[model samples]
Target: MYSYKERSHIFNTLNSYAFDVLVIGGGITGAGIALDAASRGLSVALVEMQDFAAGTSSRSTKLVHGGLRYLKQFEVGLVADVGREREIVYENAVHVTKPEWMLLPIYKEGSLGSVTTSVALRLYDRLANVRKDERRKMLSKKETLDKVPFLKTEGLKGAGYYVEYKTDDARLTMEVIKKAVEYKAVCINYARVTDFVYKKKKIVAATVKDEISGDTITIHAHQIVNATGAWIEDVQALDQAQKKKQLRLTKGIHIVIDQSVLPLEQAVYFDTEDERMVFAIPRDGKTYVGTTDTFFEDDPINPTATSEDVEYLIEAINFIFPEQNVVAQHVESTWAGVRPLIYEDGKNPSEISRKDEIWTSKSGLMTIAGGKLTGYRKMAEEIVDKIVKKNRFKHATNCITQVLALSGAKGLNSKNFEDYIKNKAKVGESLGFSYEDAKALTAKYGTNVDDVFIHAKNHSADLNLPLALYAELSYSIEKEMAYTPSDFFIRRTGMLYFDIATVEQYKSAVVDLMSNTIGYSDTEKLIYQTQLDLFIDDAKNPK
Candidate 1:
């Protein structure tokens, strides 16, 4: 396990060593590429401007399955390939990713009827190579009602149940980074690449700036892989002469609401008024409802959910449930992410492919864009294979990520996680937490829960808040690359989405926790509080 000091040392070491490969962007794809390259005995370095998964990677609907909506569009190959890869991802990260039953409600006038949905589920099951225990099932109206009583019964039709996996997207990305570090890859967040280092017209290195301390350095590498999600075009635009037209950006928005307000026991997948499918997945004692797909014109990195987006989701949920209509108040938090799809002419954004494309520039810069989360590993393998073949480097071995366990994912079965928490609590009484908190933390961090617990135990005297703990916040700063308050609240622990009130109530605690770590003076803390207050006000009254 690498500590904070050790991670700092590793970052310093990367600056000194001329790396074999340098990866820009700490999203899942970049992390995956770094792991794939390093596990093959190549020196690697990964840098990110913000925290890992701060972009589209963290703001997803958190599903790790073949996209069922693609089936409607007849994207057979893409759907099948993603389905096949999901099995591998689930196996590799069993702790954070697990099988989930998805219920697709069939409405009378919906785009997909019961019979079509059943056939689709069957095909999905076959393509995914689902185990017998995790096969798809067709349910009658009464049976569906038994599973989800809140579902609008006016549809008067059956439903289809299919197996998929759900995961904490941010935690999964962090684990990928941790695994890459364990494989000896130098990974640093808060480090932004400002420009490419060109040696006589061929890209050779990159000038990076540390976002925290304003330190700048140039790191040399044999090859540079740009895996920045929505920022790919920005990076490619650096070399205006060699720019190739690729990457279409699509905006996706999701809203989080309390599960008790909706009270659906099973995950629901249904068509909305616009004929697009939306998911209501139950996660961490709350339900995530979202994902409106549309073209966005603003900045991709910092997307805010509009009133129109929230209205779309609220209307969709109300249309489905009818009896228990959800409103804006039901929404605790909202987030938006951009999909970096490959640009194709005359195709709708939704119709554009989710398949990844790797483009090598004339200057020998490789850029990967346009892929779903489920296919990240396979995408990484493909890109690395291309790099190795292009460089004529001796292939030491085949891709081992299939059988390789991610960091802290070893010996993790569903049954032992609770026991793992109990054992940790025994080491110090202050480490004791509610079953929900313990389970959530363990699922998010895997074996890293001990690090947070140890920090909490050491600072028990100063930090004893039930909702927010200083130790957990410090652990996030030290281990999880949490720099901003939003990183800690939104991605690190999911407090922003799970419980908005909890976040508001513990505002001071959060500020206090991060004050010393980030050197936020009293005036800066007040400014942060004002910003958060304005944000809450906007959420309450969106123009």
Candidate 2:
């Protein structure tokens, strides 16, 4: 309900208030910080240069599980904390996060032997406080192939079965920001912080320009936090802070192929010949595999999957699943994301740890860098606690987000999401959605589906678009603050990655609706149109 529609009164309120906290990024880190600070009774203001999650947040591998591979690096505590948080994240956002059993097939020459995987998983379960029934189990060679029939049978001693959480990364960020807004936090998209506003050489506020309207405003705050992922150094340059610590950027690319091409039934995490690990998981009628960790020396904002990147992943997929002869031509879509990790000497991208660190500049600006998606909440809690102690704030309360559900997850939990959807989908069917569509929408939006249902009903007659498409588009415009066609197609609905055809089918109609809804100038309309076209081309060609 905390809509960020263009020209909304939220902007006026943001320009007028000096909040307790001002977050400079709208990625998952900033979104989590906003929710934690606001829920702790602090007034918070957050601004993003692009749509929320447009950076590393949306382009991640989309898993919320503990970095089990970190065990190789002896990062035991990180594994324990993140592993435990996996359940917490899933419980709070059941609609967007769910448990998937992952199969780890052991080969004779692989990095993980049968005994090592079992012992490691057992340690992981105990440290993660896994429920009794969900503990890791050792599957024999026969049992492993039974679960994953396509796994390379040669030298496959056995497999380890364990639970991991799958999620929609962008939707998870959006829902978290929405919940923060519910707690009275003010957030706006497409607003870039051009400079810092300092008094007596201490940072006090920021100079922000609306990326859409081209109007500028100065936002004052008691404390400022920098959570800009990948671009943290850019914000640090604004602060003129030099430190011994720095961020090392690496690029990871993923490719999506239809099930008819890969047909991966089980989520497999296998090692490549070079000792690098990759995941091939099935989602939304497609089997998407990826993540090549190579040093990147390009723009962090829009990292593209080069032909070499595509070739490396294609080789990995074919190596593990010898039966599926997938090639670059079979790739339906691709996405590239950059990870900003703390600089570690002599360590390659994959060798670096995923742990996060918070550093305070002399100007009182706090910058956080080098964290994984699964550890966002804890990272926020740590940063906010530092702010409270340094500022001597009193209105703050304890962290309530551990138990507090996100926007649509309120009044629902992992145990009841299925039943809630079963009952609520009938309501969507009544509003002209087919039963399957109703169930699908209800599953994606959780309790918020009811609001979308209401919006769809109001637009039943006049729209020339599909009813399902209309409901989603209308809801995104009016309720989600999506002002551009790219926002609607890419972040709001995730059609760009999961279902690119739908985006291609509805691009013109969606663009026209948004242009009219937002009152875009003819020139602005062309810009938005070109933006959508660029995104479509990038999704397919990747560069």
Candidate 3:
């Protein structure tokens, strides 16, 4: 029922009516909170400064598992909590959240030994309530090498195979927003909360400015939840009644490379020279190896991956798999995100706890911070529970998101995904495309593939990439909130990381599709093209 006109209508009505809850920050946490509160029959309005998941949500290492490394830190509660939640998340978005096997390569002098890793995997499986399908297995050196031929055998002892889930973090965040919309929540991206509206020294509402259209408006709410992740401190500063503490920001960077370059059947988890863990995850026909954790005090909005960070990842990857020797040239794209860990005296970034803490000011402005992706739903439930208790709402029900199916998640099963693609391709053949192209398109769009076919029929015929028909681009703009080519390529279709050359080659055609579908003018299209080019340049020569 949500459309472009409906979105505009809700935006206009936000200021007119006092909402039951106004959630700030449109990251996964904010989106989850909105969906949770709205599904409980509470009127909700959620606002974001940029696009949905434009912040830390999209910049994650893109894993949805219990922190395997946390076991090293002896954070048993945190690991168990995340493990239990991972199952709930996987069930909710079966298509986007699939089980992936992670191999922890045990070197002779590595931080963790084969015996220790085997025991830990057993403990993890028990704690996570891991089903038979996702049980862990221990592998000998020969078995490990057979699974991952790239692994260096010089210092290998064995490997621990454990279950983990991978996800499109951006798409998952957006799907949460879509579900919130279905539950009748008013959600608007590109809207910034400037100042808190106060009534007799108590926070009552917020003054917001639309970043895109430059329009200002005021939205009234009984309670405001600031779930801005790294920016929580900044939002909290607006409340003079509360004490402001500096948040510890840690930069985590990931480098993408073609899977064929270092093809591994499973994700590789290995210990770096510094004793910290690093992951090489296979994703979308590419491999994402990363995440160097370093303290950062720079701009959190646009944190850039330094050359040193990339070098560190390359060194760690090459150290684990000497045969591959992954160098700078092997990297296709690199991205960095800031983790807003609560500052603790004399503690390093790696030692910081991943547990979330909720803070409420005397004026009743609630802020939630310092959680990972797996616990977002739990965080949302706790936030809403506090709101109901604070407001003394008598009719609020207990959280139901535990069983709620996100949009497009209903009737989803892994067994039928292939069949669904074939059916979509058969339909796509009617719209001037080969079976191969149709298969590709259907795999990307799922049940929504029909929308793309309709778009191709209505739009111009000479579309670039017969596989990427006009309909898919139009569907992205109209339904997925894809305002720019980067939004489509980077997040929507995942072409930015998967096939960088294809994105560059079809830039003009994509711009034309955006213009025709989203009502972008020629001047606006040119501007978007320039922005995309600069983004590509930045990806090439990351700051």
Q: Could you list the CA RMSD of all candidates, in the order they appear?
A: 2.5, 1.4, 2.0
Candidate 1 has an lDDT of 0.80
- Give candidate 1 regions above 4 Å deviation: 1-11, 414-431, 434-436, 461-464, 518-543
Instruction: Report every candidate's CA lDDT.
Output: 0.80, 0.88, 0.83
Q: Scored by Cα lDDT, where does model 2 land?
A: 0.88
Clashes of each: 0, 0, 0
Winner by TM-score: 2
**Candidate 3 ranges with C-alpha deviation above 4 Å:** 1-7, 243-245, 414-418, 429-445, 463-469, 521-526
- Write candidate 3's Cα lDDT for 40-73 as tens digits: 9899999988778878888888889899788888
Task: List the candidates ranked by lDDT, beginning with the highest.
Answer: 2, 3, 1
- Model 2 bad stretches (over 4 Å): 4-8, 241-244, 460-462
Name the better of 1 and 2 by TM-score.
2
lDDT of 1 by residue, 394-480 (tens): 754568998777876777655576577566545434456655665656656667777766666546545545632565687887776
Error of 2 at 159 (Å): 0.6
Q: Estimate each model's TM-score.
A: 0.93, 0.98, 0.95
